[model samples]
Target: MTPATSNGWLLETRGLTKRFGGLVAVDGLPLAVRPGEVRGLIGPNGSGKTTTVNLLSGLYRADAGEIELRGERIDRLRPHEVSARGVARTFQTPKVFGNMTVLENVLLPALAALDRGGHRPRSEILEHARGLLEVVTLDRQRHALAKELSGGQSMLLQIARGLMVRPIHLFLMDEPFAGVHPTIKDIIMETILRMNRAEGVTFLIVSHEMATLRRLCERVSVMHEGKLIAEGSFEEIANHAVVLEAYLGR
Candidate 1:
């Protein structure tokens, strides 16, 4: 298959499929996200939303299909290789170094990026890391141990860490708003908007928060039992019979 050079998509998957023994986690899933777009991926439990993010972020390999970013094939790349190619992501559960300080958590990615041929000096990296913490409202806890952070704070730190990677082309955020306080959720939403509007970052957000998704996503795609069942605006999706049935059931 050729690179994703058409359709003006920053990220695209064609016939993307994954399986575990006889259980197909993601089946022939096709997805597309354009540059600077806040796209939502939502579905009920076990609908393959997280699995699709895993495939895109290089955490899981696809058994069949092509994954492309900016016309470059990335499905075969390793996790770090994918990050080096400008794809970054956060997990469904906050993943941070519990023993490390909040600032350190964010700083580590910058140092790693430098090792991978980044040109910025250590001082600049530090500044950038601090700036991101400020954006996520974690500057006050910069010196605190990551493990000390509350669940909501940990999610904020994850966002800061994800942003620490320079030149992030696509950020796949999995369940970003799940279980966070309303205030923290607002901060996360604001940060997403700020990144997308000011820096032109593209986001594929996976969340069950339909209300928040309606406010944040320009478009949305729905998945069910490993297959995409619908794609459109929130309005169209809300009224879609298939979507309603998938969530509400027969």
Candidate 2:
């Protein structure tokens, strides 16, 4: 099946496929993400969730498939090119500049946006960066070095960096709640919901936390062995026999 898009969806994939030598990591996957939806992608280990994210973010090229964003073809684009086209992503592990200050870590992406021919002034960039730090509740630690932050703080810093890019329409996040404290997790969850509601940022979140997914997502897709097996509301999927079998290794 080919992932089809319509007026409402922000992204679409048609027969997306990828392989490592003889092993197929993603097999003819078809998926679509609607604008303003917190879509969840969940599956057991080795289910190809990470691989699908890599392919969507342009970190890996599909062997045979098509990808589209907002009605334009994007499968042929490079990672930076995809970023330029209003797509942003975060990794399983947070990536922050250890040597840079907290504010500086977030400011770099704004500079990159300027470098890409955006006409915003330096003052605008700085102001926006500071606002992001405040949004992530790191304003007081603006001058602190990234290395000084806790694990959860590092995760917030990573997200702040991604938003510096102008006109970001889609965000692909992998395991944003992996090792953080419960309070920090609440903050992360709140931030995501705020962005989605206030900024209209669409998200494709890959996480193992089913409870979080239930709270955060309106729809969830289940992948097993590189193929999407079931998709629906959380309530429906939780009771699905196929989902049960896949999780239990039946």
Candidate 3:
């Protein structure tokens, strides 16, 4: 469902398109995400969900169109520049620094951002890192090496690391619950909800979990063959005849 607001979207894309070689990965994708809103993106394999994420995250340059964050144009920013502009993302596979301690991996982004801002105090950075670890419930594992953590813990670490930048918008989560234990999945989901509620972080999540998406997302966008096929509330899209036929391979 659209949030009750007039012209108050936090992120919007106008005719976003991307292509590679002879393939059109995404085509004329128009979407809007309000502040603190959770929007789900779903589609069958090769439907361009990941490609859309890549374009939004600045990992891939758009072949056409623009992206606006809080109404500021940001489609041309580099990936790191995008992060600095209050956009952060977590990959489908956790990319923890295996050689570093759990705390170090989480601390990297905060420290880097701070250093770039001309802050060079080690004690201050350490303290900030500790706080982030606490936020993700990883303070107890502060000294543990990244590679030693379980899959769920790794996912938590990835999210915690993303938050270290204090992003206003987040994108690029794919199959977040994949291969994680049920309890850990619950923890991850709870953390996501808490971030949105308490910090006003906007999210564009990509996943195949219909039940989870229906429960968490205010709006759902479905893609097919690199084009947006449906856009509506979860119930509206879930009950759509086209969606059923697409999912059931009819």
1-250 in candidate 1: lDDT tens per residue? 1123477889989999999899898999999888888999998999998889999989999999999899889999988889877788999889999999999999887788678788899998899988999999999999999999999999999999988766788889999998999999999999999998888888999999989998899799999999999999998898999999999995
Candidate 2 vs. true structure, TM-score:
0.94
* Tens-digit per-residue lDDT, 92-115, candidate 2: 888888999999888887687678
Name the lDDT value of residue 146 in candidate 2.
98
Using lDDT, give the best candidate's number. 1
**Candidate number that wins on lDDT, 1 or 3:** 1
TM-score of 3: 0.91
What clash pairs does model 3 have?
Answer: 1-218
Give the root-mean-square deviation of each candidate in angstroms: 2.6, 3.0, 2.8
lDDT of 3: 0.81
* Distance from true location, Cα of 46 in model 2, Å: 1.6
Candidate 3 stretches with Cα past 4 Å from truth are 1-6, 118-125
Worst 10 residues of 3 by lDDT: 1-10
